[model samples]
Target: MTGTVTCEPGTPGVPGTVGTSGTPGAPGTPVVRRNRRATRPAPAGVDPRPSQHALTSRASEDRPEGWGDASASKQVSSYDAELQRDKPPHWG
Candidate 1:
């Protein structure tokens, strides 16, 4: 013969594996999903700059001046990785 074990639900405002009211999908209880991205910080020693995310950093400084979230503005539609490979470093 085989036997089965059942578990009871947890109290309100407290986290548990079972749903509210000792049943699954019960009312008056809401499932809260954590925002993993918002709570996480940038990896140690990893640059947070948008330019640092690029495959190549041509002449961009390790800590570029006036750096901000340039994700939308820094992108070049005419950028060619292969062509830029042979071009001389740009200096202004």
Candidate 2:
């Protein structure tokens, strides 16, 4: 004769089968509980401008005036004897 297996609470049994006296939906699905903090609005009369414009304007001002100018040449001389011998014609 074939016998059926029964499991009590806190005992090991087949997966998805809840033991007797255990809560419904206990074995199949997990219970999720979340603790969330309440968000508060910012205080009144505080200026938020420093964070917005501080980096952008300062970075633009810090750049040299010659950075994007085509006429400003970094090369001191085109015919330096040492550079002419070492470098290719296309690089000069």
Candidate 3:
């Protein structure tokens, strides 16, 4: 009689295959190309910009340079990905 075996989902490689060693796209294979740039260190004295979460949080806030939350100032617009909650229609 014949039997069957199954490997766990998180198995490193194919259950019944041998692992091969060598660089990707060996001599006989085509070269791989990507549009990514290499990362480098930044200079001193300059501060890093705020992250997307921080920037979005500050932007969505209804407060302005010289305005208050309830000053009828616009916060966000209905066309934006995230709408300002509890604000007037003219705000966003």
Best model number under lDDT: 1
Q: Which ten residues in a row have the lowest lDDT in candidate 3?
A: 16-25
What's the lDDT for all of these models? 0.49, 0.48, 0.42
lDDT of 3: 0.42
Report the Cα lDDT for residue 35, model 3. Answer: 48
| TM of each candidate vs. truth | 0.21, 0.22, 0.19
Instruction: Please write out the lDDT profile of model 1 over residues 1-92, one tens digit for every residue.
Output: 12322333454554443655745434444445444555556798976665656576444554443363345556644545555566867731
Q: Candidate 2 residues 1-92, lDDT tens each?
A: 12333434444544434533355234333423345558766578865455665543534435564364223545446556576589877886
Model 2 weakest lDDT span, ten residues long? 1-10
Q: Which candidate is the best by TM-score?
A: 2
Which wins on lDDT, candidate 2 or candidate 3? 2
> Which parts of model 1 have CA positions greater than 4 angstroms off?
1-26, 37-46, 51-92
Clashing pairs for model 2 are: none
Q: Candidate 3, residues 1-92: lDDT per residue as tens digits?
A: 12333333333543322222243332332234444668766568744553533443444345554344334555545645243556688887
Rank the models by TM-score, top first: 2, 1, 3
